[model samples]
Target chain A: MASIELKDIVKIYKDRKRGTELLSIDNVSFSVDSNEFLCLLGPSGCGKSTLLNMIAGFESATSGTVSVGGKPVLGPGADRGMVFQQATLMPWLPVWENIAFSLKLAGKGAEERRAAAQPFIDMVKLTGFENHYPAELSGGMAQRVGIARALLLNFSVILMDEPFAALDAQTKLEMQEELVAIWQRHQGTVVFVTHSVDEALVLGSQIAVMTHRPGRIRELIKLDLPRPRDSTSAEFNEYKRHILALIREESALARADAATV
Target chain B: MNWLASLREQRDRLWVPVLLIVAWEIFSRSGWLPPSLLPAPSTVCRTWADWVFSIDESSQANAGRWIHDALASSVRVFVGYAIAVVSGVLLGVAIGWWRWVEKTIEPTIQMLRPVPPVSWIPLAIIWFGIANKPAIFLVFLGAFFPVLMNAIHGVKTVDRNLIRAAAMMGGREAQILRYVVLPAALPSIFAGLRIAIGSAWMLTVTAEMVAVKSGLGYVLWDSYYFLRYDLVIAAMISIGLLGFLTDWLIKLLMSRILHWQHGQTVQGRNH
Candidate 1:
């Protein structure tokens, strides 16, 4: 069964300066099966994050519906955990406390919350740094905290919006591997949004290529690659070349369309 | 040796005040200005000691009444400031959090804000009848706006993403406000508190001089009527010292609560 579903979604944003309504996402629809890792691949200005946000119930579609766990998403709820592009941790809270924020909100006592946060903290590999604030953490460590915070809530679906986009190349690669390992062990549906072709190819079991503006799903490519998918592998490169071509074609079309206008 | 090292460390903060006092004392003795009109720091100190200790009774009626007057002003400052802090923070959070609160309450608040708190002395007198109530009211009026404005700004500027994250974690609105919004807005609120405190002391003095019978401002005004400039200067110094002391106390509290901000902000970078 699908763990998450979007039906005939359309999003329109108001350009207050121009006093005009701009179409952001038009007639986007897709579903992710339980435990399926779905990567949304697109260029900047495409509503990839917007689409993920709609699933997380941070944003609502101008029309159509977003459903998770067989219920329509009215607003943001614990049922759909999200890791933002930026860590967005409560700077005032220490690592353990930030990880246990949901429990704190649920009225759990400090001891109980701390106890619960321990496993997730260890899972995210943030062991000794649990007392540290978000400001003290490096970009990669902070992102790990964000992931742990989401995972602690035990949401069946986790949505990520270019979570490692700000990290250096080395850190990003390590985090990507760690994320895949965690996903394999925990087995949850993930909707990861990214503008990177390589990131999409490296992580996604199913890659949904999106168009530039008024974002529509151009194609959904399924990957049957083996565990620990190598970026240098021939199959991975083939998938990368194909997705790159699709993105290149979309960008060319966007440029041509702009020229005419 | 330790005291010497500490004094050396404090040299940057100490030099200006020391220089000003020494120059003022020399100028007062040099007769550049009448000693009575601009009493020397030494004269003020002597008068202040007499007022506090009743040494030679030079401060006359105010001698040995210093503690009583200082306590009265301190109480008024504390009560009025406490009320302002509570009401301002609550109203501010409400104004910042809800559009309805902002739309309905903020306009009237903004309208009242620009009207000087000192101008309320007549109305304060008429309403509360030359008592502590009028002085307290004035203090509230003076301190309330800064706390309210800062609270609103702080709440409004709390990272939107943090709220979104909390909401996603199934946090109720009230819980989010308490756990997320309040802590995030604290630095701004404290900033407001500091400014409001300064205003609090100013209003207290202004009120004491006109509406209330006791306090440092009353002593200042009464001494001026008696033509006792030394006692008047002493009263001024007392008020200034009290204001500085209270502000320093707040800074200490701010440091304790917002220790998380240390090394995270530009102000905290030196340490």
Candidate 2:
């Protein structure tokens, strides 16, 4: 059985100001087996984050089902951990306290929460800055705390919504490498959403390309490329080129649709 | 040199007040105004010292009664403000968090908020019988709305994503409110409490002037009846100083409890 599944999902948002119903996701369906790192890649407004949110139970589908580990997702639960686009750490909590927040919720004592969070804190390379508040950390360091917050939960599925989209290029590359290494050690299903083709190519075991607004899965490409993916190599460039072409065609069709309307 | 430089800075800030007091003394002694009607700052200071130290009978029946009156007012402010803090925060959080609470309770509160607290004086006397109860009731009326309104705004404006983050972690609703919502809303709640504290003192004195007769406000009003304008001015100065002290104390507590906010806010950055 798949670790996470979404079948025939359709989401229509009520735009109250415009007095209209807009379709954001249309008949999208996919599943991820346990231990699969599936990246849902597309342009902005593709409803990929919406799909991820549905799986995480932050939102419900207007029609159809989202289930994890053979059970339907009714609402957000500890079974699926999520890392948001912005590092939404409580501004009032220090780094370690933020990482140990779930433990705190679980009624763990301060000593235990500190001990439990240390490994994940160290795993994310934020060892010495434990006492620094969210406001004190840089963007990259704060995002690491966010990642650690999710990773410490030991959930069956992890959903990420453009978790590193705001980082500088060097930090993004470094974080991507660190994330893959951490995922290897602590294997679980991951569904990452991103607008960057290179990011998807680098991180995903299976890349699901999504079409623009009224989003649908356009294609699913599996990568057998060796680990430590070399973006400069021919095989990597070939996959990047193909994904770029697909995105170009999708945008061209979108422009045509606009013109006709 | 460091202490000297700091003293210079302090002196710069004191000049305006010093000049105002000097001018007032000159005008009062010039006999342009009746000394009995508008005593000089020097006369007021002498009466205040006598009232505090019982050095002489210049302040008459109120001499050495300054501490008693000040404490009485402070107690009223404290009791009423405490009740306001507890109930206002509880109700405000409930209104902010649940639609049912907001719908049922908030409208009535909004209607009641506009009625002047002073206007409640007659009702307060009839209801609580012109004792500490009436004075405390008046203070509660003055302090409650600020605490309630700011708390509602604070809870309402908490980052939606933070709640989502907490919910995603399997935190139950109560846990989310206690650990997430309450802490997130605290900075705003503190802001309300500061405003409420000022109102608490104002209403306490107002109540003492009319409904009750023990605090600094009573001293001022009673001294007026005896035509001791010096004692009246002394009472006014006492209320002002006490209000300043309470506000400073709250600011100290805020800095400690919200230590995490130390470098985050624009105000914090300046300090």
Is model 1 an incorrect, acceptable, medium or high docking prediction?
high
State the lDDT of candidate 2 residue by residue for B109-168, as single tens digits: 999999999999999999999789999998999999999999999999999999999998
| lDDT string, candidate 1, B4-42, tens digits | 999999999999999999999999999988788988898
Minimum summed lDDT over a 10-residue window in model 2 chain B is located at B262-271
lDDT of 1: 0.93
Residues A58-165 of candidate 2 have per-residue lDDT tens digits of: 899999999999999999988778999999999998999999999999899999999998998899999899999999999999999998999887545789999999
Tell me the lDDT of model 1 at B27.
92
DockQ of each: 0.86, 0.89
- List per-candidate RMSD values in Å: 1.7, 1.6
TM-score of chain B of each: 0.96, 0.97
- Give candidate 1 regions above 4 Å deviation: A14-21, B31-34
Q: Judged by DockQ, which candidate is best? A: 2
TM-score against native, each model = 0.96, 0.97
DockQ for candidate 2? 0.89
